[model samples]
Target: MQGNQLRTFMATEQLSTFNPVTLQLPCGMLRGQRLGDVQRFLGVPFAEPPIGDFRFKAPQALADWTGIREANSFARAAIQSPRPPTLVPDDPGYSEDCLYLNVWAPIAPGPHPVYVWIHGGANMAGTTAQPVFDGTSFARRGVVFVSIAYRLGILGFVDVSGLLGEAYRGSGNNGLRDQIAALEWVKHNIAAVGGDPDRVTLGGESAGGKNVISLLTAPGAQGLFHRAICQSGGGQTYADQLMAEDLAQRVRIHLGGESARADALLEATPEQLLAAQASLVDSYPAKSPFRAVVDGVVLEQAPLASIANGAGRDIPLLLGWNKDEAGFYGASANGDGGVVQQELANMSLSEFDQILIRYPEMFPHLKAEALRFKALTAESYGVPTLRIAEARARIGRPAYVYRFDLPPEQGAFRGLCVHTSELPLVFGNVQLPTAEAIGPVEPAAQRMSGIMHSLWIDFITAQPILSDATTIWPVYELGARQVAILDEELRIKSDPDAGERMAWTTWQPVAAE
Candidate 1:
């Protein structure tokens, strides 16, 4: 055990294989490797592979196995292209059998807090293997981190029951059901990986955040998580009531198949279905109709309605939106010049005039751009938070609200903290390179990362995020609403955008021409 001899032994041993062990899941015993003092399990099947006969159907329980399965490499992600055009790599893979989970945990015996991450891709795209999503940082900090893969696109959220029957009644929420199954797996198996099932925190950004809200209202997901962090994607209002069914029928016709039923569509290949779904996106200029349906069972009712009636009353929540969420939407709408122009054109004369009435001087030069930004800010983030915050306040539950305003350093999008900007920061992986559309992360970004991650850990452990280093985050109140503005320096602001808030408060859908 001399110093030189010990050094030689350490050099020879692979750090990732020091304390390997087997995890006994309902499906099988999986061999998990070790990294430093933590045990890492990747690509563990939480549910049956959703391929062939199971595609588009609700996730099924993983079948039992006798041998130890290798849990090391990440499984194939659900069929999806990357986001924002620039982020999509040259050769990204896709598949139907993509229901899997990755875990990072301390190699100790006692149970520890667990953080389950749901990724953001607007409910259409995104995967669990994004470099920024690596959970090792959180695991290194003594929290078990889990990243999960759920169904996406047509396979994930098409409502065909209107044309089908009770067999396909809840098909619209298949993606959501996949998430619940992952949580159920965590509840039953996290202990084997040294995680406390009781202290699970469900969190995500954008579409992932939307999923967190869906879980909050979904009855099947009750008691599966104790704390929730929804960033940037709060306050999702379903685009239209018939959108889900309409999208499904479109898919059926595009496939050139006679059967327009949900069960019949399940027999199609994943690629064929995804192509059909993508075609719909190309055809529709306003918005994609594929999203979680308000089924009387899985979703029960609109999340806003549930929150209004105290659905997730006991669960503590940390929710917020970014300052420039619409910037990203504008970038995504690049190919559709007509859509972008129409949106910009409508911003001034549309309902957003109420917003212009308040911030008439904010961006005097680019009137249309400013108007589009304000309108989107109201609908996407502002109104949703107002609705949910009022619901949470009414139910007497502790909730903290925040607004992220850390602007990017380069490009026309400079000074705007667009959607998904907080992803790299929250995960403490801001060092990763950003694509063209997403500028490089600044050196000062890590400070905000530390703050956000620490607050999240504190919330999961203490129910209310407590910190002495930053501003005291107060529980949101309906009337005297207080919000913590996250930036270079945290500031406590009251009614930061009163004009935009009032606009969303009185928002109503306009009739289609």
Candidate 2:
């Protein structure tokens, strides 16, 4: 393992050039590869492949390796529903063995803050492999960026705790476990990749936003990430244990069996389970089928109640939702606009009356469809987010809040300030399908992109948000209600919608009722 032979081994494997990409990890040596100025280590396993008996289990740490492990390509995405063609590469693969993470670091050294990104797809579909989530920009800006792929759909979110006993109690949240494993890898090995483990930031959008919030309160995920950014996600989206158990039972029966035995389910293929799970979900329209659960272990309680009780109070959280989160969110496998329509139709006499009376005046000019979509967005995404901010504020923990009020170009997706509109801006990948569909990217939008990206990098790097005096953005305050507005002009403002905030404070969802 000395001089000449070692040098030959490293060179042949694409480890490094004049500047080698070899990093000594607790697990083993990871010979690096490059993509331009950024050194990338992809397909690195944080956990053992969750296949076979490991299918319904928490992620197990990867076994130690002997020589340089290949990290030049991405691992398969979690086996789940298909992703939008626009969001995926040409030959995107799928697998149950999908607990891999990718790292991007500058070619030069000295530790930098690490940004851990989790993709969003209503907790059902998404991959770190998306072009929009590439970490090259963050790396170039002196931050080590890592994106991870985790379990989804039936494999990740099915709760069999009650039926299967203690062995599989944490099965419902294997995806969260996968994320924690990735964080654990960061804590242990990010230093080798020019990252400061102590300065890790967790960020996500949409369903990924929900994951960030969950990790904030997640016992296993504590102390793993220092800061968090939750975009257009934060609601107590967890299904109660009874509900999850019931759904699991239905899924088993739909697979042509009434047996509630673990062995029975173990025999079924992932495709069979996913198909049956989807069938069972079609009946329960308004709720996300594959979601987190209060398993009394990994997650002690639901997000709202848990965080309100001061869980993750010490972690700095930044949150906001899009101007229009509904229509542009695409169809969630759990619940879509059609399901919302059905639920609205079935509301009780009193509930229906209340909405009919209040909504029109509240959103005066919105058409029927727009009104429904906006209401759902607020209830599902916006209101819960504000509630999270309030929860933190009540506990004497200040959280940064923003309202993405930027409008898109006219005739491009009809200029809707829709869900995920800020993604390209944040990632500095402005050539997305959404951007094209929304027409030309304006100069103001481009400026906003730089500002937003800089602010994000600044927070992660533990630096001041700006180099100026006038734009000193303050953390949100309950009394003064200050928030950053990201749009044509970046400025501070009071709570964006006072009336809507008040409505949700008193309004509970139908399930809670």
Best by lDDT: 2
Model 1 residue 312 lDDT score: 85
Weakest 10 consecutive residues, lDDT, candidate 2? Answer: 337-346
**Model 1 alpha-carbon drift over 4 Å, by segment:** 1-21, 82-92, 239-241, 257-264, 331-367, 411-413, 434-440, 463-465, 468-470, 508-513
What lDDT score goes with residue 78 in model 2? 89
User: Listing every candidate in turn, what is its Cα RMSD in Å to the true structure after a full C-alpha superposition?
Assistant: 5.6, 6.9
TM-score of 2: 0.89
Question: For residues 1-513, what per-residue lDDT tens digits would candidate 2 score against the true structure?
Answer: 854355347535543442447778889988767755788888889999999978788898799989888677788888777666655633468888899999989977858889999998867788877767878889999999999988987788887666566889888898888899999999999998789999999999888889899899889998999999999888568766786787678767877667646556678887887687678667764446677777777787878888888999888888998777666745434542233433331233355345545767898887666666677677667787888898898889968888787767665345567777788788875544434343225787778788788878877787755422358778777897777888876788888778778765555643321
Q: Candidate 1 has what TM-score?
A: 0.87
